[model samples]
Target: MKNLTDKEFEQVIFENQLLILKICSIYCESQADKDDLFQEIMINLWKGLRSYRGESKLSTWIYRVGLNTAISGFKKRKRSPFIQTEELPEHSIDPKLQANQNEEVKILYHAISMLKPIDKAIALLYLEERKYDEIAEIIGISEKNVSVRIVRLKKKLEQIITKQLGG
Candidate 1:
């Protein structure tokens, strides 16, 4: 497979930025941290592009690289404070519509944030509707293990949301 030229790389990242951000959101608690993780994922993706051999779908490769970078960032974060010179700029998709959905999404993300790193990755992939085989491939786990973990994770999320809502 040919390496992506700089423009091609930029376009790919732009098209898939939301996927990267979703993974980041699962792993990061703060908007500032999500923004930082997104940038780091893009940098890592660019660097990893050269090593692409078309062994898996491009999206799978992106997921592997992004998740690995975020997990690495988690380790680095323990030793140093995250520094930010400016606050993340906010964008509203639709005021009323977003306001209604935001609370539920926020609660779900909070619950996901409580998961272990690998569990968080698994859950995010499941939520993204990735097939079992694809999730297994990306996570380097057996398909059956992915199934079992996702079952347990779903129950865990139910418990978390129930507790959060005092149900």
Candidate 2:
């Protein structure tokens, strides 16, 4: 694959920015850390673009690269204590539903944060409604493995939420 021209690169990033942000949010707790992770993912995307072989969907390629960068960032930093923040910047939701949605979002993110990095990647893709085959493609796992991991992850998430609620 040839290098992406500046315009093509910009357009690709612009189109998939939300996908990157969602991945960052799943991996990073604080806004600053999220911002840093987002930048790293973009850099990796730019640097890896030439190697993209057009074998997978563009979004799938983005997911693979973005998740790998995030997983590496976590491994390298190994930070135990994250600076807690109120929330990621809010998006416009129906005013009446905002509070309810925000609380649910917080709980979901908290539960996801407890997962191992690779499991977190699986959970994120599952929640995004990606098919098992696609999830496998992104993570380089077999479809069967994706199914097994997702089932285990769902059970684990239930336990986490139950514990959170009980406490």
How high a TM-score does candidate 2 get? 0.80
- Candidate 2 CA-lDDT value: 0.83
lDDT of 1 at 16: 95
lDDT of 2 by residue, 66-148 (tens): 99999876546545466343343455223465356665577778999999889999999999999999998888889998898
**After best superposition, candidate 2 residue 88: deviation in angstroms?**
14
* Candidate 1 deviant stretches above 4 angstroms: 81-101
lDDT (tens digit, per residue) of candidate 1 on 19-84: 998887788766667777887889888887888899999899999999998886755854667754
Name the 10 consecutive residues with the lowest summed lDDT in model 1.
Answer: 89-98
lDDT, candidate 1, at 140? 95
* TM-score of each prediction: 0.86, 0.80
lDDT of candidate 2 at residue 81, scale 0 to 100: 65
TM-score of 1: 0.86
